[model samples]
Target chain A: MMNKPFENAIDAHGPTVLRVCRAVLGMTPDADDAWSETFLAALRAWPDLPDDTNVEAWLVRVAQRKTVDVIRARSRQPVPVDELPTSIAGTDGIPHEADPDLWSAVASLPERQRLAVAYHYVGGLPHKETAALIGGTTEAVRRAAADGITRLRTTYGASAAQEGTR
Target chain B: MMDTNNTPEFDLASALTVGADEMDSLRSELARRAADDNLLDVTYRTIDTPLGQLLLAATERGLVRVAYEREEFDRVLDTIAQRVSARILRTPARLDDVARELDEYFTGRRTTFDLALDHSLSSGFRAEVQRSLPSIAYGHTASYGEIAALVGRPRAVRAVGTACATNPLPIVVPCHRVVRSDGSYGGYVGGVDAKTKLLTMEGAA
Candidate 1:
């Protein structure tokens, strides 16, 4: 077996995985890093992946894990201070790569709500799978997704529409 | 708003803060890393041609397969998966050299391809037959009996015909240069018209 299945998997679901990474990790270069790591890991495991696997769900799961790894790595890089400001701009810290307005909106969302929105809406997983992946019940995941979507539409969505006109 | 007419799901999914340029860059970056890590197996892409679309596939070794649209590209890919490896991807960069060469060949700017070929799909006497195809030269023709003689299997004329019919790498191998003993255009895997078109293009018709 070669990388055909792996390549096909990438082509079929690259955008969805990117969205999942971006949504979960916020719209930053870290999201790109997570996306690349997910695919690279998938490539290394391509030969062993079963042919009948649901590739979409598989990629989403991998992206989520990679996003977690990215977050962990980011946490390891810190400056000696009493308490780092939650909103560190381009001051003496590692520059965050993101559309500031876009990320701040998503960042404002509650963590579980953000994960619910990302895994369900952007990753295209059902509420059941989202719940399982995020360690919650289906009903909770659904409600989280609904609230997250409403919040995103008001914040990120409205800002995007305003930018498009300008 | 862009969402005025689209479905809610479509609107939500397409309304990402990341623009098209970012997405394109991300895809290229992923492909670059995949190729660098030697994870690419069977990469392919469609190229425009006078004979309709041609699906060009390549492996790390070289250009492995070139398929006509009528070949039902998906079915051809399945064959490649079975014969070569199941790890096929549609990466255009992997086929860039061969595609550019083929484009040059089509436009009459190049007479010979300067790229490597992977003939994994052919074997035995048929493989020998394929090896002899390029010697027939550009703008030239060779009879099946002549091919039979060249491969030192003079009596295997029908077998030669089969070899030509099943030539794994066609244009690169120049199987289109082979004709019938009676100086008639023989059968082609890409159909008689395509064969005729190739011959005409070669100025050997």
Candidate 2:
């Protein structure tokens, strides 16, 4: 099988993976850590990848596993004493350019709906593939993503538009 | 069945998009992390030269492949991936020194490259003959027969010609200095016109 250099894979899909991580885990060290871990894992597996592999889908799958690992690790850690309250406006506890309100709205989504949105919308995977990543039928995954979007619109869609599409 | 597509449109990706600068830094950071972990097998970048865009690829060992634009960079990358390792990236940081040296050489401010060389792309007699090319000096030309003799096989002039024609590292290794017995530019991997331009630039023609 003719494999491409792993760098091409990184260039083509790194931003999408980072976006998915941030959308799912927030723009925190957790997201950055997940992104790094995902690519490092991909780089290790890149050489032997089949020529017909859909690289973006593969990376998003890897990112899902990495994100899950981060989440499990976080659950075991004691909350920091100086942790910022989740209700704060204009801050997701990180100095990123994205609207904290929108992220907060995304954060407010149920686990299944949030994952479905992050994978199918932000990660740019089709419903079938996203279903495979998060465990459901394609129809269920599609409904979860739509429900997540409808929730976000009712919650913080005004701030997202006011902030202007970045 | 709920109409999933009928939900009011919201641009989630645009709202969540990382800025271009942030993406650049993230990629650079990952490259650094990969290098530190020994996961980056080949890092490459392109530099514009008087001839054309030159594709420079390196391993942790050293600079390995220098290819001309006409070489179809994609094909060259495929060759390196197959012959070396498939773990290659287009990172400029590893090639900064070589790019600087090439710039200096093209402007006549530098006479030789001080960068480490990687000869993994060539082997056996061809590698040996190419290894002997750097000693040919700037602003000078040597015959194929002379190079064969220099490599301790005077009767292997044809082999020397093959070596020069296939030198994986060209201008850096100074294969342009090898001429025909009758004082003509026999062949060059970068094409004969590029050979002449390099010779004229070196004032060897």
The candidate scoring highest on TM-score is: 2
Tens digits of per-residue lDDT, candidate 1, B20-91, equal 445556656777787888876777888899989988888888888888788888788878877887666666
Candidate 2, residue B94: Cα displacement in angstroms equals 2.2
**lDDT (tens digit, per residue) of candidate 2 on A62-119:** 9999998988888787974223123322223345565668777787788889899999
**Pairs that collide, model 2:** none
Note the B-chain TM-score for every model: 0.87, 0.89
Misplaced by over 4 Å in model 1 are: A1-4, A79-107, A136-139, A153-166, B1-11, B17-23
| lDDT, candidate 2, at B62 | 89
Worst 10 residues of 2 chain B by lDDT: B1-10
Residue B39 lDDT (model 1): 76
> How much is B191 displaced in model 2, in angstroms?
3.4
Chain B TM-score, structure 2 = 0.89
> Which residue runs of candidate 2 sit more than 4 Å off their true CA positions?
A80-108, A126-132, A135-139, A151-166, B1-16, B152-158
DockQ score of candidate 2? 0.51
TM-score evaluated only on chain B, model 1: 0.87
